[model samples]
Target: MATKSDEDRASSYEPSSAGSDESHIPDVQNDCCNPLEETKYIVSESMLMELFNVCRRCQRLATPTVHQRVGTMVKIAAECEFCGFTWLWCSQPHVGSIPAGNIGLSASILFTGALPSKFLRVLRCIGVATLTQRTFSNHQASLLFPVVARVWDRQQRDYVTRAEDRGKPLVIGGDGRADSPGHCAKFGSYSTIDLEEGTVIDIQLVQVMISFQRTILCCTTMVL
Candidate 1:
């Protein structure tokens, strides 16, 4: 026969939520929030470029073969020479996932007074709508955007080198603008350009909270 104490001990061992109240739980508010990522389908250009040409497991060459094409957009399939592991790859500025290169390109275009909608519109006109602009925009905001300054600097250096090779002095120009129609806007920008080449050499931004003079002093700050 069980004693009263035994019954109490058994009840204590059973599940109880903070004096039998679920509300006391921390970290988990309602256990009803949906996950932000549904399915991970993103692949970068560098990754794809390397994926098909090398065996991930055996470290051997994976001879790439063309599998499909939608006009210039291609899907390159490969099988490893040693392990026989197979995978698919795509070209630069991915039609499936937005490439890191495109992140910088899109940013440069925006810096040059072009709207992001123009990129989307061009993609649509080309019949390459496998990827959405929103997805690329999100990627630019999250991942590739942080390193775009380095990319821009590299681009400028390369362009300068090319101009030097041409043995001609660069005809440079500059401009600045508010992001919106009115002066009371959240953001503004300043840019220097290679007028002869029609390429932006460098750009900078100024937040509304900061003074315009300070914008000149610390104006190398860029945005995406």
Candidate 2:
């Protein structure tokens, strides 16, 4: 015999149309971009909409204007002729953006991979047709910096606060290096180290010429 609780659950759990959709939900909640399937990816839709400027409600072409362009990544603004609804689109999706499109990574993964800067130019010049100068610059400023900052901040918080490291001596170390072979290069770097963990705590580029001691001092100041 069915229990009272079973009957209550049976009445409460009436299947709705959304229940069918539950099966269609992706295993991962946030899928960045699906390059294999164009219709399923939001970025592809946006790209197509930018190209066509279609009004979804009326099924007519809407007037599109250039809102912004980062590299070849042009963002278009458009409005529905009948409904007056407005929308925006980008020429290239974040996943479809350069480096990733050519090399296959979001901006976050590019710098972490530590692929040399020359590699990008080499790729573009040698007829790796997808890579471009603007894509490199755009990824550096827009995607790479912000992602790296967040990751660095998170690492500092997580590693420093670990129970093993706390109450022990703060064993810090650092090193500096020139961007190019020359000692008089415009770009150089200083990195703070967590000696206890054998990991780099932070890395910052020294934009101007400074004494060796001053550069070391900057790294020390950051970890402390």
Candidate 3:
């Protein structure tokens, strides 16, 4: 009878030992072999449309100007009603302008040449692309655009080559007067391929033109 009792205790103790080992094993595995988890975010079309609407409203309120300096060459100036937020638009089909009312979109648009690379790097570091669906407050949008644009233009050359290779054509089209000075310009255009693909992926060209205003400021400041 004592032998039986001893056997039971030994068997029970054996499981405890195995359980302890199993617990410790997972910790060890986590230290060396744990797999990475991918984080993801969903972006809905409605959200994109809302962003577009806000941009349009803001542009109307801002009242920008457009004019041609030479034959077929034009420039646009966009300014904000609530702030000193200003940007320039140009008639270059290979480069588009940034949008108003937020930083990420404006930066992404103005700094198009550097966007693909820097944006991907930022997304990876954050472990996700959750920014796609995020809506920016008017103030946040105004502040964020210029900062991102500065960073983007700083490394513009490095990324331009890749952007060109990707067959992304920069096109801007708008309905504002071609030879008048105004604050807000209503326009829209998309890449030739993206438009051909039947994708509703048109970007705002007036915004791009507005964002370009920064280039003029930089040049003026340099001359001063």
Candidate 4:
């Protein structure tokens, strides 16, 4: 059910000159990039095509250019045949070089410690479009990991500094967990915690040896 306001909002897709030298066309709807007022809408393809098929300026059918789609983000450029005007519309906003959707999805997967391959498989199985594993890995290395690491280091420093500021000996506890029983385990994790403050201080992942063979396996295993 499309309302008059929604129909009117379609006109906001302003076109730039096809001959313009602008490498990027900014989305007017989300130009500010304000996090607090962020909003997301799941729009149907049919509805989107309905709005894009006609050139808002000339009120005539426009020829759409080759759609540039990156995972969940899509950019549509349409040129009005009559007026020779061109406009680019993006499905999601951009944060620097990466699309907001890509960043959000990648960050969510990393923060939650979810397995990217399995989680993305779930999305793909259910018809949800998302970034590929390679893209996720790239984002993790180039963007997500650095930020997360910096924040983690800062937090760890703060926790330790606060404990030291107390001018007393701190009680700490340490524990280790293995992925499997006996020598079959391929990985192990050790964690240190402040017993008095009930806060985790550090976590380290260690590779386990199996049957006198050095097998380097990278994975998180849950004993459930």
Task: For candidate 1, write residues 1-224 as lDDT tens digits.
Answer: 24557546543332222222111212211134322212224454456566568787787988877665432235678899888898865543331232323434445554676666776678567655233455445545544444454456567667757876878655666667766665667677766666778887666676644544565444232211
Q: Candidate 1 regions off by >4 Å? A: 1-138, 182-187, 207-224
Candidate 1's clash total is 0
Which is the leading candidate under lDDT? Answer: 4
Q: Against the unseen true structure, what C-alpha lDDT does each candidate score?
A: 0.52, 0.52, 0.34, 0.65
Give TM-scores for every candidate, taking all chains together and pairing residue i with residue i: 0.32, 0.41, 0.17, 0.67
lDDT of 4 by residue, 103-172 (tens): 7888889989999999999988976767788778877776677676666666776786787688887676
Ranking by lDDT: 4, 2, 1, 3
lDDT of 4 at 122: 92
Clashes of each: 0, 0, 23, 0
The C-alpha stretches of model 3 lying farther than 4 A from their native spots are 1-142, 161-186, 192-224
TM-score preference between candidates 2 and 4, better one: 4
In candidate 3, what are the lDDT values of residues 1-224, reduced to their tens digit?
A: 12446545533331111211111211112233212222223433344223322223345445455533211223456566665566655432211121111223334534455554465456547543222322222212434444444444434433444445767554322122322365434442222112233322212243345534543343333222
lDDT of 1 at 209: 40
Worst 10 residues of 1 by lDDT: 21-30
Residue 106 lDDT in model 1? 45
User: Taking the tens digit of each residue's C-alpha lDDT, what string does model 2 give over 15-70?
Assistant: 22131211221112215756423332224434555664778668786777766543
